[model samples]
Target: MSENRKSKVGSSAAVGNVGKKARNFKPTMKKLISYLSDYKLSLVIVLIFAVVSTIFSIVGPKILGHATTKLFKGVMAKISGTGNIDFNYIGKIILLLVVLYVISALFGYIQGWIMSGISMKVTYKFRKDISEKINRMPLGYFDRTNHGEVLSRVTNDVDTLSQTLNQSLGQIITSVTMVIGVLIMMISISWQMTLVALCVIPVSMGLITVIVKYSQKYFKQQQDYLGHLNGHVEEMYGGHIVMKAFNGEEKSVHKFNKMNGQLFGSAWKSQFLSGIMMPMINFVGNLGYVGICILGGWLAVKRTIEVGDIQAFIQYVRSFTQPISQIANISNILQQTAASAERIFEFLEEEEEIPEVSNPVKLQNVNGSVEFKNVHFGYNTDKIIINDFSASIKPGQRIAIVGPTGAGKTTIIKLLMRFYDINDGSILIDGHDIRDFTRGDLRSIFGMVLQDTWLYNGSIKENIRYGRLDATDEEVVQAAKAAHVDGFVRTLPAGYNMILNEEASNVSQGQKQLLTIARAILANPKILILDEATSSVDTRTELKIQKAMDNLMKDRTSFIIAHRLSTIRDADLILVMDHGDIVEQGNHEELLKKNGIYANLYNSQFEVA
Candidate 1:
């Protein structure tokens, strides 16, 4: 028992081992820097400006030292009657410093413009690539992932990395240049003072290394918790009606509070450490400055160095410390930016489910005969949903599939649409395997109406036109009339142009279903699949919908799936499925005569209704 407890504890540590993961995780800085390859000219300009800016900045302090030293010498010369004091050098040095300041400011503006453009361009590229990849992905990929996670990756994560790349990169470059330039200038003035300044580096480095390591872990956790919170909020809001109907608000709030509390703690820790960076580095910088001032003052009093040189060294110490503090402060932003980059790259690294064929087959003008030959499939490998399933339908045959829920009813339609490929066997269209046809050519032949319809935020006309992008207004009207939706649509103030937001939420469920029927009809597909299309509507509406379905299904190969068995009485073939196998199949009267599974389901629904 003791050994088992120790093993369990060890397992727990492995599961929660964030520190080990972080240590092993490598940031994609090299890949990120490759984005700058296209911006070589801009980068060159930035580099030039940074160098000029640092040079000018370094000169300003040295000029002040020279001027102060000259002024003191002039006073001494006058008191001692040393004949003359030269103000010419002082005047030239003052002018040079002023000119340098002007050039530095100009370069600063140029650098800002170029880096901002580069960052925005990189962000645009990242977003565009993600969008394109999403378009090419299989539908099942989205079914398993949260919508909010995708949104956060594109918006929040990309935005965070963009700011870091643009602003932080520039600051790091400028700080390093300024620090180098100041130290070089300091050594030229007096190596003794340069040595004193260098002494602070060890202490500053030790403190920063420790703080950064701790802050990095917290920052990454902060991002992860925030992602969880976003996912929770999106899920809760998306299912609000169901939650409220079941009075699950308290439970939802408790879940949200738990996620929110974790986010709050991680965020506080990350930000608190980042916030302390400037002040802590500033204190260290001040200590170094005091040392420089004290040591330089002593050297000057002993006449080992000119008073002017001491003054210049003091200014150099100030300049050096300022950039060091900035570098230390910017380290936090760098870490955060690196964390965001890792996330964005991670998303980009996900392998797309549907890869384009090296030599794709483009099929044209398909005839509607479909065959499923011993198909086996599953969303995952462990549990096969459709096993050794075989079905064949002739052109324009209307088949109705009635099954218990989770008996691979909807899975059939999904597989037919290539939303997923069969694990074994082949689905054939026009006697040709579906995998032999290009995805576009294969999907173009079928139109599907689902149980839960989706309408985009657009005018009514636009939603119908989505079925056929180039469909005419007259064509749309004809389809709408056939679906029996034209009557309600014409009554709206805007007629066909009436705007619908939140997917026609203001309309009744039956009307929404009708609109979807109109869309499917507009497509004029050779094959149709209705997955419980009329199940949500009232009896009267269902009858009306049945008439529309009759019109739509005419002379087309139609696959209808529904648990409401009464609606499928006129189907050419009725397949009653149980536990992923067809238990009975025949015409409606034949199935009724058989007194089998279909008859039992029919009687059960009739009793319930």
Candidate 2:
């Protein structure tokens, strides 16, 4: 039991450290406010109405207290002097209360409408900015980050901020103003009783401070757990097929349960602490109220204070305590909003890839003569995947690159496309360095089909049209036939209009690869790249795909990366690669005679097949 207690204490200390760091870790209020810049008018309107509404709230309670005092005095005088109630005085008090109620309600509506508009405008801009930023980010950024983490930043964090703005801001403002107005009223009624009421202020604040410290830590943990939950679920769902095939269901479930249990505990702790806040404040408030009541009654009965003054003092005490309690509640929300704002701002501040040159040269109708001069490249600064590599291809030549896995075969194509700039060399397209051309110009010159073909959820016609947005229906059909995918499309219920399911899961792997080839064909690029394109298909499908590829390669520069040697047997040039260097180069017969790495690979998989 002692050890358990000590462990709990240590865990609490760690949580305390985290919370303190989060609270003091620079609020992004200024950065978050920038999103509201576009809606300056609405924000100003909200502030104006909130101030007016708060003033009305303070005035209404004072007017009620004043009317109650007047009624009591009038009743006492009438009963003693005339033995009848003063109807005129009664009517006046009723009229005053009604007037105060109407004014308060009117300002309340104005405040609500204005704040609602501000919240909506801010949310809209927040979503739009994040979306645009995601689009502008380099492709490699997404490769390194999880999908669900990014989603949590946009969807969950922004959603939390939206609620804080809509529901909490106006109440906080009004509550604060009411507290100030009530304090002044209390002093006017009876300074002694007012001081008594003030005694609880510091004590209540101290208690609230302790609770807030506890809650802040749990809230931050809660947000992180939610993000983890999102990421875990995404991973489990995306790889369900692999998991089932490996018989890893139990393992996956155990992992999920552990994460889910943490999420549950964190959520409960956060909410439970927040829920206790209101009641705790109320309890302290009741204690202060009782103290004030006893003291004020003693002074009133002794005639040191008026009966009316005691009544007003009690009213003021209630007003002060209520707003302080409300402020405590708002403080909790602000902590959460601050936590979410940190995440959203971090995303906004992420480094984007360098922007395109102001005036880029556009390559028109590229002839597809490619040259790599002493190219050295790496995805990261410290690691070089391709070192001092060089290659040249004349227009319309079919060059095949064969290598063991991780020999930088795919890196060649990436460099040509400028996905990551070369670390130590340059690439030229038709005598102009590729960097001189705009991204669109460089990409428009080549069409690609990878081993894992991905199709969007859309009709076959639409997917093909994505390759060349301006293509006519006839052009799409021609390209499909050229790629030998038209026959399969015609067999579907909707032909070209048939909708592909998610990631083209509804189609066979071979058919999906062919459709992707059709997409590449529709673009009519000057150069073509086939990166293990036929490896995932059946023998018959490979034959048909090879026939289509041969037709597609005609009069175009083609660079083929293949593991199977038979696919590249007839190439004009075959380069055997090892450790990012070209060790040998020749046609199939020549490489076979040399009997190098290429010959061995060919003998193992391709020549024998």
Candidate 3:
């Protein structure tokens, strides 16, 4: 598997899902054509070369027929003792045939080379477009949709598009040209024989039509099942440890087998239906060849056509049906390409995050005195998860949010950072509405260390440098020392230079959090958000990390969300939340005296002990 597929293990990028109901194909196809509008000149050149090449090939049979006729006439004259064999005529015909075939081959080569470049260039553009599109899309889109589905569009669907362009596009041009050019040559030699050869065309069309009608549904289903099966595999692999701990291995295996069976059924059915076309067309072609031979023989006996004309005409008829067969195959390829294309276009057209305001306010000395007034929001409008919430934090205050699992602790941090806009009212930072500032400007004022640690595959030093790109090596070490990450680095073989693997699994989870804390220290933001940042480590490690975070958050406004209530006893203000609303607010001693929800949650941790 590619790195992209590995990264998308739990997302739609491994699976395929087009947002909304599947659109009509014609409109999707029209949109795909619009992308090709940029390569019109290359397409025209490809067309000219294909036509020229086919025309050269089409004329070969007629010229070869002339040689056959000459040899025949000369032989009969020799039998009458009036003429000898004409080696000069035969030599000239052979030379002409060689020249035509060579030119045809050259044109075909140039056409393939040009189309290959065009296909690759178009695919590059599509990939770039998608990369840009995803960044601009709102975070809510990812929240609502499957990440695996998006991954499939980027890798699988785009791959199909590239193949079709490189192969089928050129084939369509050459096949059409060859069919037209061969038709003219056949009619010129003997229209009566041409008619007999053309007799099977309608039957061939009817067969193709019926097979295509039934086969397309299977092709579409095959794509869906492939994505579905991929989703199952991705999920199983991602959470295999959890499945095993719960003794659900048999269930997981059974689920995979079921999906695999569905995928196999759709996959082979589509292939078998499409595969049947080639042999059926070949059978029709053979019948046409037989009709031409029998008819041409009768014509020759009557002296209506020469034996050589019969041979050349037979060649032309054969060439004619070969392209028709190719076109049928290309037709099937085009249908699959169209399906992939529709999924690609659907993603490109998805609703994006509202564009940032032009000439937005830029913060100058952000002290991070944050306030939320009557803020209403939700991941979905039908169900509001944050309702009429309000809060005010003084500069340099540490606010600890304590609640049960679903009590909107992290939602407050997300809203403050403007990851999602409020449905009503405003979140103000430094006395200005957050929306007044650009997202980049707003986010730059704050640093975050979340429950899930994210560390890219890079040297430890480079990962720290991401926080402040121009920070000196000494500065990186200083930040590492402040976060206690320096202690761990000394034991590593490469020290700070040791490389992290793809998942950053080289370091322990507690160590990963320390590195992130070091990065946040390097950033030196005016505000900080720690969402269960120390929850993964042992008690000893948590104490060490908590000390480092305390130093890092000193004199900076910070919001800490921790499930362990004891960790936030020193917070200036403690907010007790239930559902989307805050139920109580005060210092720890004050909230404990109230004996309300906050006191109950705080005492429960000790009750278990």
lDDT of 1 at 212: 85
Q: Mind giving the per-residue lDDT tens digits that candidate 2 earns over 1-609?
A: 110011112111222323232443355767666666877777677667766766766665566665666777778888789555556776786787777677878877887887887887788888898999997786567665666667788888899999988898888877878888788878777788888888888888998899888888778877766766676677768678889999999988887787678778877888898899888888888888898999988887888876767776776787789889989988888878878888788778888866777778776567889999999876667877788898888999999998888788887887788876788888998988888877877888889998768789999999988889999999999989987889989999999999998768888888888888899999988999988888778888788889989988999999999887888999989988887788899888999999888878988873444
> Candidate 1: lDDT of 385?
67
lDDT at position 588, candidate 2: 89
| RMSD vs true structure, all candidates | 5.3, 6.2, 3.7
How do the predictions measure up, each by TM-score? Answer: 0.93, 0.92, 0.94
Query: In model 2, which range of ten residues has the least summed lDDT?
Result: 1-10
Backbone clashes in each candidate structure, one number apiece? 0, 0, 12
Considering only N, C-alpha and C atoms within 3 Å, which residue pairs clash in candidate 2? none
lDDT of 1 by residue, 1-609 (tens): 110011111111212423221332444676677756888888888888877877877778877887888888988998899845668878887888888899888888788888899899999999998898788766655665666666777888888888986887788888999899999999988788788889888778777887888898887776666666677787778778899999999988987887788778878988998888777877877887888888888888888887888878877887887888778878877776666677777777776766656676665666679898988887767877677888888888889988777677887888898878889999998898888767787788899889888898899999999999999999999999988899999998998998887647767788888889899999999999998888768898788879988988989999999888888899998777766667788899999899888888888876854
Candidate with top TM-score is 3
Model 3: lowest-lDDT 10 consecutive positions: 1-10
lDDT top scorer: 3
Can you write out model 3's per-residue Cα lDDT over 39-112, one digit (the tens) per residue?
99999999999889888888999999999999998999899999987989999999999999999999999999
